[model samples]
Target: GQHAELDVMRKVEGVAISPRDTVLVDQGMMTGRAGIFAGGDVIGGLMTMTAATGHGKKAARAIDVWLSGGHYEGHEKSPPVDFDMLNLPLFLDAGRSQMSALPPEARSGFVEVVAGISDREARYEADRCLSCGNCFECDNCFAACPEQAVVKLGKGRKYTVDLDLCTGCAVCYDQCPCHAIEMVADVAALSAEAHRPLRFKARP
Candidate 1:
């Protein structure tokens, strides 16, 4: 009975009556009927924080459009700010916080699975992040290079290594505190690769 109706219901839209007495609403958006929107777990699917936030934003925009006699675009027109430029302090390290698990005996039955870290412990963990100099550009090589070859392209421009006058001296690589800059070989000429072997055989 389950397999018979499930096969039929899969093809149908809106409402479907199955032999197993299961009621399926395939498209919830159509069921709202009033043209007002509704969504989330009640409609049935994976519900996450990100999805909920997005749905809320969509609903608010729709309401705004309806209230304005449908003339409004119902979308935020402001350009989003680049998060890298925001310079907000990261509250935690790049790694996930270690959660204290319930004991095996306790875990067998229903019990709170994870314990929270204390305020002091959380703060100590947050402090461990190596801020890695200024948010994007580390000024170490910029400060150290005597040739002054390294140029700040601006906030929009990622680092552009000027090979024309770079000389392949590797002074920039040496001075970088965060080890971001690497001394890559100049590939402009075939002669540059003469000594730098293309590939090496593994040891026998």
Candidate 2:
């Protein structure tokens, strides 16, 4: 129910305020004044915890870049992962871990009701994540490739396919458990070689 004291900020030169009484910011969450930034509730629009957290993270990055005298281009956003994209067969069907809670009879004013899961239970629940479009480096594509085209680029670097060794087989694409590999026609090879060439797009 508390209101934002925007009147105080209005006195500052080059700071913009919207018609909705919210602070105005640019793509980098910066105000009209240089080195100044605002986000979350002050910026208005979607007023949720998740939105606020995202805003905070973005603003922090922008602030860091500004401090370093560099422009913040920001990280590219990936497409949303759909349920159908997940390899359901790879993950076991496990029920959600239930948290312990106090009984109705034990309930009291300002008392905690739900008790959170243990560290082991939390780890188990985390392991159940389908990972969807994100590759977990399961080595399925590496093993399934008949021509040994899939090349491991070490940990966190992901895999790359050797175009010379690849024979246009969709084995790597089919073996990818997370659906991270996409098969597209190599236009350059098709135009030059007069035959279709396999291009694997493995998103990191």
Candidate 3:
């Protein structure tokens, strides 16, 4: 709380800010000086709890790698998902559930305004998630793959494609609601397409 102004500065002693901006971060979330990494509100851009959480995670990873004498190269930024990209049919049309609130009489002090939802309500709310841009491991790929190429690695681990068994039929890719699966053709597949015989129709 005391270092609130540090939230707006260009650099912090050993750290160097970008020439073009006040933000301090390189590929590995490293500041110019050794070992020190900065993120969160200090880095600017999206000023939200989600953005701060992401920064904290990235900074932690970078710090760990720095300690180990390695670098944590973060992923390249991709374009944000648009509403059109979402598979709306996969999500139920459920209205946002309001949190149970304390009665006006009980709101005199600094008590929390909203109470937690019931387990059933939580489940219902979770069911309404569109799961845009990220994989929620729905197992649609596991079921859709005729060759049984999709390996279920249990919750949080997600599924991996068994390339040997995957014929590149793209049934799994097509069936994926989140568009998480990608069909990457091998050199052999590409060469086969180049050499495939084109049939000529006989003149009637």
Question: TM-score: which candidate is best?
Answer: 2
Better of 1 and 3 by lDDT: 3
Q: What is candidate 3's lDDT per residue for 1-204, written digit by digit as tens?
A: 322245334435667665545456786667777777767666677767789788887788788888998878775554555677666676666898888898888896778888889898989887877766567878887898898878888888877766667676767766777656544436665667733122111111
- Per-residue lDDT tens digits for candidate 1, residues 1-204, read 112233443444544443444333222232223343444443334455556566566666666665666632444333333434232442333564687888777785566788888787788676554444322465656676666767777774635544444555566655554334544444444466544322111111
Name the lDDT of candidate 2.
0.83
Model 3: residues with Cα > 4 Å off, grouped in runs: 1-13, 16-23, 64-68, 77-80, 99-127, 193-204
Better of 1 and 2 by lDDT: 2
For each candidate, give its TM-score against the true structure: 0.33, 0.69, 0.65
**lDDT of each model, Cα atoms only?**
0.48, 0.83, 0.67
Ranking by lDDT: 2, 3, 1
Q: State the RMSD for candidate 2.
A: 4.3
TM-score of 1: 0.33
Off by over 4 Å in 2: 1-25, 29-78, 193-196
Clash pairs for candidate 2? none
Per-residue lDDT of 69 in model 2 = 94
